[model samples]
Target: MKRTPLYDLHVELGGKLVDFAGWEMPVQYPLGIMGEHKQCREKAALFDVSHMGQVILRGENVGEKLEALCPQAFATLPKGKARYGFFTNEDGGIMDDLIVSNAGDHFFVVVNAALRHQDIPHMRAHLDEVEVTEIFDRALVAVQGPKAEDVVGALCPAARDLKFMETTVAPIDGVECRVSRLGYTGEDGYEISIPEDKAIEVTRALLAHEDCEPAGLGARDSLRLEAGLCLYGNDIDQSTSPIEANLAWAIQKRRKEEGGFPGAERIQRELAEGPARKLVGIKPDGRAPARQGVEVQNLQGHTIGQITSGGFGPTVGGPVAMGYVAAGHTEPGEQVNLIIRGKAQPARIVALPFVKQNYKR
Candidate 1:
């Protein structure tokens, strides 16, 4: 497995290592998953996300060329703002979900670690006469929590003024970096991109803050799950469409009306009518956590769907999950049974985002 630039720092901090998507990543610290989860919600947590990919696209009509490839309208995004959307195949299957930022001279995209290899070629093939540079030597880190702004502000004062989903070039201890006000935790956080050689210095500076503790992928997963955010392979994939995943909101209004993106016909039809199945949040009644691949069944023992992502939510103090079920069975308050440990555990459909997001607008 590959090691990130912060591998040594993780070992020094006593991070429990695990294999994640071909990378040797820290799964948790000595504080454990629960502790890390609580710390992130109450204070600030720094995450080494150097395994993710950073790609820069440049050349003439770059915005117009990329606008056709992504679902989000990139042409209208002002300088320094970031947008989240998917690169879809002609059939509407997701190639990858990415965060794109308008970096004045060019566009900067951050893609998932697992999809980096495939995403690079896929993006390049579709973009004509565009120069794509893969900055694999760069390292990325995330500082997330309610007090994230205050903690990061002390080190990089410019970050405090950035709105959610915005990016800016800032200096950290003489190292040039791109600080973006975005994170996976549904908190007011920032993802900092720094040169490979300067990563350790910047990470140490953030950790020096009293409010910041090192968090791992384990806590990050639970945080996003509680926030009702989709996990690429689990909640969404090539087999699933954005409409079926209940991500219609990610599709802008004008794009929906114009219907030009990939799989637009099917997506538009589903939007106008309704998908056969929809992703919904489920709250289990007991301590038993409904895990992925568990069958979601109706009261009459009929299998309606399957749990895509499920686990005990530390914030909610209960077991929560998100899955797709037949449309008629997706309404809030609908009762469903999740088969866990050979028993049919009682569960109910509830409003998404089990924990409300506290993003700084």
Candidate 2:
């Protein structure tokens, strides 16, 4: 498995390493997953996310050319602003979700590590007019929590001014880095892209803060789950359409009306008429966590859906899950049963975000 630049540091910090998306990543640390999860909720926690794929697109009409690949209105995207979007297949299925940032003359895209191999090639094939350049010289890290401002602001004051989803290039500890005010933990934070050689130094400096601690993948997954954020290949994939995944909010008004992107017809149809299924939050009745692939049945015991991502939410104090269910059963407060370990367990549908998002907006 490929190792990120922080492998040695993870070892030194007593991080439990595990294989994730072909990378040797830390699943948890000596602090434990539950502790790390709470630490991020209450204070600041740093994460090593260098394994994600980062790419840059150049040439004229970069955003316009990019619109052909996704449903976002990037043609009007202002500089220093980043927007979340995804690539769609001809059939309206989501290929992969990504974040695009307009950086002056170019656009920077960050994709999931596991799907980068396919996503990059897909972009090159469809966006032929744009100069697609994969960036391998930078490592990304995130410091997230209520106290994130104090931890990162002490090192770089410019970051304090950035609102949610805003980005900028600034010098921190004498190294210029791209700092974006966004994160996966549903907390106020920043994702910093640093030079590969200086990654360890920058990470160490951030960890040195009294309010910051090092968290791993275990806590990361639980955090996103509680935040109601979708995980690629799990909650969404090539077989899932954006509308079905409840991600229509990412599609802009102009793009929705013009119908120019791939599978625009199907998407427009879904917009006018809801999809057959909808992804919704699930909360089990007991302490037993209903994991992925578990069959979701209506009160009458008829299978209605399947759990995609499910786990114990440290903040929620119970098992939390998100899955696609028949449109009829998507309403909150609806009762359902989860087939866990061959037994039916009672559960209920709830509004998304088991926890409130703490973005600095």
Candidate 3:
């Protein structure tokens, strides 16, 4: 197991440690999950996401190579912009969901911490003449919330002008970094990539702002869930297809018509005819939370699906969850039952993103 550069800082802050993807990480701090969650929603929170893998691909034909490897068309991406896409297997199942950014002469990628090892090899196998460099000694930190813009803007004024899904190279206190105006919290935020040696300095600088507090994985999980974002291993995995996960928008219209990339045929078919099961949001009637792996049943007590992600939504003031249900029963407001601890808890289908997204356009 590995620890990120900020492990000492997390320990100093009294963060409760836990094992995540073979890395020693802080799950929560003394403020607890609920407090950290609120701080992020109300102000700004800093997350040490150094365990994630950052890789750069460079070559004359790197765009074409990436287009072949990913479901999204990288050739159309403009410089200083980022696009979210999935790496799919031959059967149309997702290997991982990653962000691809156009960094002038090279492409920058941020991959999930758990899939870093597998993803690197998979990506390298498809490259013919591209330079793949793993930035192993770098760390990623995200400053997220409504006030994030102002805090980050104070350090790097150029980043304030960046729109959602945009990236720019900027210097913060003499530390060069690639700053992206993107986050999983559905808020106005920036993800900064800094050298491992400067991780503490960058974190300290961000935390100096009165609105910024150090957040942990517990808050991140809740925030992403409230935003209806999927976790790699739980909500989406190799067995789940993009269409089945209700992520059809990830496949651009141009790519759909041109038909390139692996599993294009299967994905196109699903787009045309729809998938057997679809991911949808569910709102539990009472405070009893619905948890993952719980069976989803219809009014007649017949199981229709299983909950993939669920928890008490602080913003919503109730329990909210997402799961894959048979397509026929996925309509919003449809009556459903969640079998929680052998008790059939009544629930209803609802629109996703229980909390409204506040992304700055």
Best by lDDT: 2
Residue pairs that clash (backbone atoms under 3 angstroms), model 3: none
Candidate 2 error regions (>4 Å): none
Write candidate 1's Cα lDDT for 1-361 as tens digits: 9999899999999999999999999999988899999999999999989889999999887777787877778878899999998887777767789999999999999999999999899878888998999997889999999989988888788998999999999987778999999999977899999899988988999899899999999999999999999999999988788888878888888888886777777778888998889899999998888888999999999999999999999999989999999989998999999988778989999999999999998
Tens digit of per-residue lDDT, candidate 3, span 113-192: 99998999988888888888889888999999998987888878888999999999998767888999999987789999
Stretches > 4 Å off in candidate 3: none
Q: How close is candidate 3 to the true structure, as a TM-score?
A: 0.98
Write down the TM-score of every candidate.
Answer: 0.98, 0.99, 0.98
RMSD of 1: 1.0
Q: Give the per-residue lDDT digits (tens) of candidate 2, residues 64-121.
A: 9889989999999999999999999899999999999999989999999999999899
Q: How far does residue 245 in candidate 1 sit from its true spot (Å)?
A: 1.4
Clashing pairs in 1: none
Residue 85, candidate 2: alpha-carbon lDDT:
97
Q: How many residue pairs in model 1 have overlapping backbones?
A: 0
